[model samples]
Target: MGMAAVIYMILSFYISNKRLRYYYRFVSLLAAYGLIMSGTRGAMIVPLGGVAMFILLNKNTRYIVGGAICLLFIYVFFAQTHILDSNRQIHRMRTAFHPEKDASYLVRKANQKRLAEYMVHKPFGEGVGLAGMEGRRFSRRFTTDIPTDSHYVNIWVQFGIVGLCLHIAILLFVIGYSAYLIMFRIQNRELKGMLIAMNCGLWGIMLSAYGNNFFWQYPTGYIVYIFQTFLVLGKSYDKELAEQTKLEPI
Candidate 1:
């Protein structure tokens, strides 16, 4: 929700009406507060990833430099120092930066290795609903007992390398196509910003999905679908905006 609000806040700036724009920004900020309180490590990536992508897509050099500095400071605070360790939320978020030292991460890694060995001969995976807890419930013929903590891992174990690779290829294509459209095709500045913001949010969510199944879950799934719809509609939006601009009274 916070991630979605942050995207809305970014788009709200392009809104023409002063009152509506301010209301959107103010409400988004209020909603963004939930991001901190939730303490879900993966959720932290949404904004950070969005900012990074924004820097790349946006041509504003000054803002890019400023964003870079902020990102650097965040990295130092989260990965290098324990300055905010006293704060429970901050401490939990920091763990995401130090995967080697995180016990749960290590466990997940070990489980992945075990799964890899077990599924080495099965290139197409043991089959759907047959690799994790669901697999155990269905059958033990080739079930993996370790918990499927990450969606990627779950996909890999169930679909095998072939399936995983195909899935990733599709994601890469979507990201690449959207980026190309944003950079070269989209002409409306506001539309460009909105599209880039969505791209960034998705990039973050895709990466974070490795930690949890954000793609199939509530809100994120809907958000992803909606974003894709807009992404493919970029040309139409640009044309509409161009028409609207021409028709506006000078």
Candidate 2:
């Protein structure tokens, strides 16, 4: 799926004369559906959030309103049809805030706590792949099976606090730099929209990382790098545009 999205993005970039924007939108929507079908809640939100960002950033009031209504209707219909249980959604939402008291949430907290304690002494982490080994070992010791799913926690377990901090710093830098470019460098409406969409997608990954180890996992990890590379390329594009603009006669 990640590879497909990257290919779609590259195609969108190269297809300059066609309605590439629409193509990109459709591809992103398809990716979102794939994430949903995967049953991974964390990955599922990226496309929805990306669309919302696209609407918001483009100032497309009609589409924004329509998307909101559609989302609300879907939620209501799912709840009414019992395709999705309102109670579970509510419980999970509440658990996010009161994680210590929620069973699944508590397990995540416990793992985070244990990992943090271990990192305090080793600071650099046990090394990559160590977290998975530790998780398996711990599960055996406790005679219970619960695997770690958090990118932040996994990084800490694998590379220690330092690696986690470095990873977070890179994410923050990408978001901050992208915002700067959009605000100060980009003037073309179409280009601005693309940058905003890309930023929103990155934001979705950032949000999802809190709950899933997608940052370093197969397929998703490569996708994250591709997204980051896109941002870097955007920066370079913006710089060229700036230079061109400066050289143009006033």
Best by lDDT: 1
Best candidate, TM-score-wise?
1
Kindly list the per-residue Cα lDDT of model 2 for residues 206-235, writing each as its tens digit.
Answer: 776787766766867776777777765676
Measured against the true structure, the TM-scores of the candidates, in listed sequence, are 0.89, 0.65
Model 2 clashing residue pairs (backbone)? 125-160
Against the true structure, candidate 1 reaches a TM-score of: 0.89
lDDT of 1 by residue, 90-205 (tens): 89989989888989888878877888788899889878887667578777764556777777888888898899999888877777898889989998877887888788778777
Q: After superposition, how far is residue 97 of candidate 2 from its true place, in Å?
A: 11
Clashing pairs in 1: none
Report, for every candidate in turn, its global Cα lDDT versus the true structure.
0.79, 0.61
The 10-residue segment of model 2 with minimum total lDDT is 137-146
